[model samples]
Target: MPEPPPLTNHGKTMTSVFSLLGRNENDLTAALGWTLRSSPKFLAALTGALSPAPQARTTRIDLEVSDQLGRTDLELHGADHAIVIEAKRGWLLPTVTQLETYASRCGSAPIAHLVTLSDCSPDWAQMHLPAIVGEVKVTHLPWSVVGERLASARRTSAGHERLWLDQLDIYLKEALRVVEVNNAEAYCVVISNDRPGGGGPHTYREIVEQGYYYYPYGWGRGWPAIPPNFLAFRWEGYVQRVHRVLDYEVIPSLQDRWPDIPVLSESSGDRARSDVTDRPHVLCRLGPALRMDPLPTGINYRANRLWVLLDQLYTAPTLQAAQRESQVLRGDAVADESASI
Candidate 1:
């Protein structure tokens, strides 16, 4: 029997095995466990990130280990420390009971830690999960952070180590939707009216005609750290227009920023009671709307604010198609000309 070809070799001809295997929680856990077991440097980096103090050397990597409480997704048994991991798909988090149960399995190791890996943000996870379950310290690690750390580790690695880390990083971003906006070559922000159907000053029509868009500062609303090259407006279940970002400014109020425009002044009056008119806002000035087909929004699309690659948004037939195409272009799957969107 011949030895199987390396994972890197398969990238040119077929979709990544990691991407295919990562479709479900169990499979994803197995894939991650395999990576940690195969790559010593990656494992060390992960453990170091998980622990404040240096972790004891990992001696074993176990998957779906059975116990009285439940089966843990993955476990790293170190010489003096033990780490129990519960992997969840999508934005799901492990139940409190599940976390406590897994924490119990950590035993008498000097450093016992319980970690949950999912698409949910770390802050969100921290709010939901207990800081500590018995003697075991608990924490949430977002897949996005894992992907970023892998990319960072890969930068200094060589040979097979670098290749494996590269594939896993791509798998996390492409298949799991653990994307980092900063990594994109060129991306656009898609914004929608706070109240889509309700008559308002910031209506899609008003924004298009006025050639500007503004979002209130802070409170989970703001622009990306990396300024987007384009701004897209979504309304009536479609992305109606995309505009090149001409310029932007942080202003105390809409009136302060563009008092000369009567429509904007009227908008300021409408928002007076809400205090939004007086609050600081990121006022983004934009170029004329691009002439293109309106991309129909998908049923699963829920975000009022989201980011999409500029090229993908322009080239894809639908909003969903744009997202899928972006994943493929990022190396999540093999690009097939005949493949249906």
Candidate 2:
């Protein structure tokens, strides 16, 4: 038999955090168990989400409850449900039949769910999940949805309990990085001033401040076939930062004022107002401003630049790192100012 690769330090840390055997104990399955046992607020949230009857508390929280099939991550007994959760930190999605086995083992419990850090589940799981496995109603929840529920629970919690819940939120947001920024259908538009009439950074900043995104009516076919929550990047000659994360309403024609238009005229040295108005234009509402720097080196600036594909913008590594740094910087600044005072 071949030896499996040793767990990395980070993996070990995750195991320690999630395991049922106290903080020093290393177990990958501890997190759900600990939260359910220790955090009353979280338990309440979980149970409420799982069932209508709120679980005030649980009598038992069993970790790695096994059946003929496999071990479940955490099993909460003596609550509103014989709730079984399979928590996964990485992208490894659960098989539908595997979940069905856990659900079957849950027995008379009306609610069972699989919680994972992945943004989505597999196609087969998606199609087959929520189906009854024995009497248990199976549910699939992503970490972000779970985090929001926990956050709601945190408000009602207090002291150390609240502190623990807060820690869970931080863990979900930072350690897990499970909070998805874009919808599954959302896409990227890595556009720059590719033509004589295309806008620049000054125009990009104006669009950002004004809270509207504009494209010339004659730019392309009727509204770039993209879903809402699409990202728009501004390539400022040197670097590309996210100009806007956007959701749009089509203006149909330049004359339609459903979404307010920018002041322009035939005198702007672009297309004639009358000439442009004949074509449909997109009146997009700008979303959150993001700051990401130094995208994948040597991007193609010509040919297909209008719909330049940069899927990594959804992850936006630099922006997230910058945001974290800003939080720390703000805290330090506050401390310095307080000391000076």
lDDT for every model?
Answer: 0.68, 0.51
In angstroms, give how far residue 192 of model 1 lies from its true place: 10
Model 1: residue 19 alpha-carbon error in angstroms:
4.1
- lDDT of each residue in 178-273, candidate 1, tens digit only: 333334433333454443223344544576568877665432244453246577777677888888767655555655655533333225545543
TM-score of each: 0.55, 0.46
What are the RMSD figures for all models against the true structure? 11.1, 15.5
Instruction: List residue ranges in candidate 1 displaced over 4 A.
Output: 1-13, 19-22, 178-341
| Candidate 2 C-alpha lDDT tens digits along 104-140 | 6555544444433333434323553555555566666
Colliding residue pairs in candidate 1: none
lDDT of 2: 0.51
After TM-score superposition, the amount by which residue 123's alpha carbon in candidate 2 deviates from its true location, in angstroms, is 12
